[model samples]
Target: DRGAEMEWISQYPHEKEILLPPLVGFQAINTRVERKTLVVELRPSLNLKSPTIEEVIGKLKSSYLTLLDILKGSLQAEALVGPSEERTELHESKAKAAEELGLQRKAHEETNPRWFNNALNYQEASTAAFAIDAKMATKSILAEMKTSGAYTATFGGYQMHKLGLTGL
Candidate 1:
């Protein structure tokens, strides 16, 4: 039956204990005709103890890394197609995701700077994060393109960096 064939792909880990949030999952329906995709957005259960601000920040960082891995071909092939033609789309999507992650991370930082600082004080440097910033850096790209008349729109807030564009 159609109902029996529906499957949901979880983006974030789901713990029996709640409190942790921003949970997200996607539902996909495959049939003889075409494919259908839906986002299973969940408001965190929020049952567990309130996590310290640092815990949320750490989760955001981990989520970012997980997404980076997803974009870097680290996930199961069946999960994310990562097609060549869809590279740009994937890259752009990741950029937006990363931006959201960064904003959340920054919000945590603002609330608990000391905890955030201490948590990251001992962590290893994120090379891929830095590289993604470099490859996807679009401020200068847009500036140069503007002068060349290649881009006409005024860029406001944009996170245009991604590892998928390294070859390009």
Candidate 2:
């Protein structure tokens, strides 16, 4: 099998094994919607599986709900500046984006609670893509610009939609 060279090439198969999951895991995390726009060229090198139609729909629904919740939290529309103000601004930005993205803010509130909750969990998981070691050095600053070069690729916008991003 193709794997025969895998062991033969290295005495430290353990090292290879250990490195394997983290790399795959990180790629899984980095290849989502929000992070995609910031990590363009690096995207294809990750060799991740593209989400299928059903998977895409599921991702979209959950992301839509998460955006709804964040929007609900930031209706005040206050100006968020500096580190202390960043969190509030980010929340407001996310909420505003959801509105612009066709999330149907009013109707989202009346939707099934169970489905909504599930979407929140999915959003959290997808957000981890930015946390991978490959991204640790540049995620915060790069992602903030709404132009980390992540979306230069065709799949970027689609992935972002899956993650519930709208106005980026």
By lDDT, who's the top model here? 1
Writing each residue's lDDT as its tens digit, candidate 1 over 1-168 gives 112211234344352322223333224443243347544433323334666556765764555455445444422232244665654544554455456445544444434333324546424224434444444345435544666985565433423443222323
Q: In candidate 1, what residue range of length 10 has the lowest lDDT sum?
A: 1-10
Superposition error at 161 for model 2 (Å)? 8.7
Q: Residue-pair clashes per candidate, as listed?
A: 1, 11
Candidate 1 Cα outliers beyond 4 Å, as residue runs? 1-47, 51-125, 138-168
Local distance difference test, candidate 2:
0.42
- Every candidate's lDDT: 0.44, 0.42
Error of 1 at 54 (Å): 13
User: On residues 1-168, what C-alpha lDDT tens digit does candidate 2 reach at each position?
Assistant: 111235546778765432232123232334334654654223213324855445555655566656545543433242233455446444445445435433454555455534634756445533542222112222323355445565532324334344433443
